[model samples]
Target: MVKVLQQATEVDYGFRPSYRKVWMAKQKAIAQIYGDWEESYAELPRWMLRVQLTMAGTVTVLKTSPIKLGDQVDESTMYFHRLFWTFSPSIEAFRHCKPLVSIDGTHSYGKYGGTLLLAIAQDGNSNILPIAFALVEGENAESWSFFLSNLQSHVTPQVGILVISDRHNGIKAAHEAPENGWLPPRAFRAFCIRHVAANFSLSFKGKDARRMLVNAAYAKTEAEFYYWFDIMRTENPAMCDLANRMEYDKWTQHQNSGRQFGHMTTNISECVNSVLKGTRNLLVTSLVKSTYERLAELFVVRRQMAEAQMGIGAGSLRSTRQTGTEHPASVAYNGSHRRP
Candidate 1:
């Protein structure tokens, strides 16, 4: 709160309400942006304040330990090496705003071989919303399963959520595994098309063959997709045989998950990754705190853009995507664009 006072203008929160029911989210985010300021900017114009905040602060303060509150009163002193969840007011920042969720794990460079599993969603507005995240070890079926199970435990479930992710052996099994008396069945899992193609291409020869087969998998319509599948099956019986045996169709779920380009291979998740390239690697305390803060900055930019557009940019709501519809995928803060 002290930091916020230094960074933001004194916008009277009385009478004039510019937001919807989610006022708290907006307020918290505004505080975070200004809270990093070195001195008060109360006299600055609002737009300039936002711009100043975008390039505000130094790295030392960015990585400083969070101010601990009150007196410590804990019995157990277990080392918190892995972080399981993350919270932000703009958590719902996504374009194809849907209850749709995606979960993935990135290996941590820290000791003990750790992995972070992040569960994200699309919010009411079209921002790549981050629901919850977790830190785990060795991203495998057991770890992923526990992560998903924990996510389910935390959030409120929407009617039909189609979760898009890779066909990692662990994740696939975790989705299919008998809930161990827990977890949900409707959490339809989808395999990354690129991963599937790359893995399948490794088994065959010639560039044409790989391209042909890959196209078949991404062919827009189910008819076209299946048509390509059959052609590939004939061209490379071994590949088809491998796919059938592994039941890959059981995981090719996104095509029907009601989102723009769900049928095609869209690496939006990786696009998000490119945004945090170095930041994720610099994470500490088992949590990518720095990454989280940077992401907040990215969201502020998106918020500004969203304000400018004034018009709905396709996947701009928790709405579904279908044939002929186009949506702007979420933008990320590629660290390379550092404002010197």
Candidate 2:
């Protein structure tokens, strides 16, 4: 901000403003443009209503605390507590993507501090698709329960889905709770390998120990996983004990039966978090607006790419029909030249 002010003001007036002045001016400009923080909270309902009205199937859940006067509730008074929203396209897109969800939270830098929780999925082409978002007071058991419960109830209701996240107690508490639908036979929970390795490093130390943990996590076979496991045991017996306590099935690829879709970390969710980094400091409504606009633009671009791919596929099929001795359809129907 100071640099921008220097470029805009100093170049014209040959004078540089102090940091305080620039900051105050920026705050005033933000207020003038996006309104104050309290007003942004007031606008959340209207903005969310417009989103749902225009985009059918969009889900929004807003939790607010009602203000009370003596024994009666003031109908006009309410304070924003939490919000969970997901777009229709994102919800539909998850159906075709891998049956895995990675969730993570990042701190919001707005004047009214909060945390943004994200749930992301990976498409067949390995593209990251953000499926749901929630703004909460912080990353706690209650907040995680609020986000994950809504995510499962509305966004990812498919049973036996794999959920990957860090080893936060809040996430564990929420995921392990029987009513949250994140336990076994409903949805499986896995720890992010990166976070697991980081915690291991804190105890074991050294890059070699971390590398061994990562190798074990990425092993495609039980034998290969044990090979790395033995190496960690040889390096430090304590490492094996820690791994055992954390449960090998949650972090090891071999135990998940490919349900993890080769994802070992919450990097996809963190990538989406970084994508929204610029809007973190904006007013609440503006931050939500930015996510909506950015995701809409992303959907438009991906749609164009998909259409282009379809066009290319059709062109190749027509060309093959014109130049080939036997039709591709006959090869598939007759199963003569098709390889099993």
Best by lDDT: 2
lDDT of 1 by residue, 1-340 (tens): 2234333433544334333323444444544654422222222233333433554421111111233337754434323333344343433233235656666666654323467566666555445656566556577777777676655544524434566677778877777766622234445555666777677767877776667666765555677767767877777777667666644443343255354234334355555555555444332431345555666786788778766564343333323245433333432222111223
Off by over 4 Å in 2: 1-26, 67-76, 324-340
The 10-residue segment of model 2 with minimum total lDDT is 331-340
CA RMSD of each candidate after superposition: 17.9, 3.9
Error of 1 at 60 (Å): 24
lDDT of each model, Cα atoms only? 0.51, 0.88
Location of the lowest summed lDDT over 10 successive residues in candidate 1: 57-66
Q: What is the Å distance of residue 234 in model 1 from its true position?
A: 3.7
Query: How many clashes does each candidate structure show, in the order listed?
Result: 15, 0
